[model samples]
Structures are given as structure tokens and as C-alpha cells.
Target: MKTLLETLGFLALVQGAMGLLHEFTDWHVGLVQRVGLLDGHEVYASVALIVLAIALFAAAERCEAD
Candidate 1:
């Protein structure tokens, strides 16, 4: 259980970081533009959701452990 929690925490951190980069930098947008979906606001919203989900999952895991 401890290992599972730790792994989840790490995954959450990685996902959150990716989301942050996507939202705050142009690098991700450039990539998205190349993929031809750049005009869609849904992509950005999904990234935001990923960040929020990771944060909430991590928090929940910690609380459960405690």
C-alpha cells in the first residue's frame, strides 16, 4: 500500500508538471498546433483537468494513508 501510494504521488507530480508547462508555456501550444487542433479550447481545458485531477488524487491518497 505504501509503495502504491508513493508511486501514485510521483505520477501525480509528473502529470501536474506537464499540465503546468502546457498552460504556462508556448511549447505545448506549438506542438498542438502542429497536430491541427490548436484552435480548440478543449485541449487546454483538458490539460487543466489533468492538473486538477492529479492534485486531487494525490491529496486523497495522502489523506487515506493518514
Candidate 2:
């Protein structure tokens, strides 16, 4: 459970960073730009993802693996 949360947190961090990078530069990477639902709100979604990742990590730390 911890490992899963950590992995998810890492992925979210990477995606969020990549989204910001792509928006500010010509990187052309990350999944943010590929979502039709996001449209012009990728940055906000990326930030939200980062926040969710943090919460997930905290929850993981408080959980007891079976």
C-alpha cells in the first residue's frame, strides 16, 4: 500500500512538473496537453494532481499494510 501510494505520488509530481514545463516552454511532453476535458485548464489540473499526490502519500503513511 505504501509503495503504491509512493509510486502514484511520484507519477503525479512528474506529470505536474512536466505539465508546467510544457506550458512554459516547447517541451511537448506529459499527459496534460492530451486531455480534451482539460482544454485550457491543464495547469489547474496539474496543480490539483500534485495536491492529490501529497494527500495520497500522507494517507499511505497512516495506513497499515495487510
- True-structure RMSD, every candidate: 5.0, 2.0
| Span of 10 residues, lowest total lDDT, candidate 1 | 29-38
Compare the candidates by lDDT and give the number of the best one: 2
Question: lDDT per residue, candidate 1, 1-66, as tens digits?
Answer: 656655665665555455456656745633333434545564564465466656667766786879
lDDT of each: 0.56, 0.87
Clashes of each: 0, 0
Q: Give the backbone clash total of model 1.
A: 0
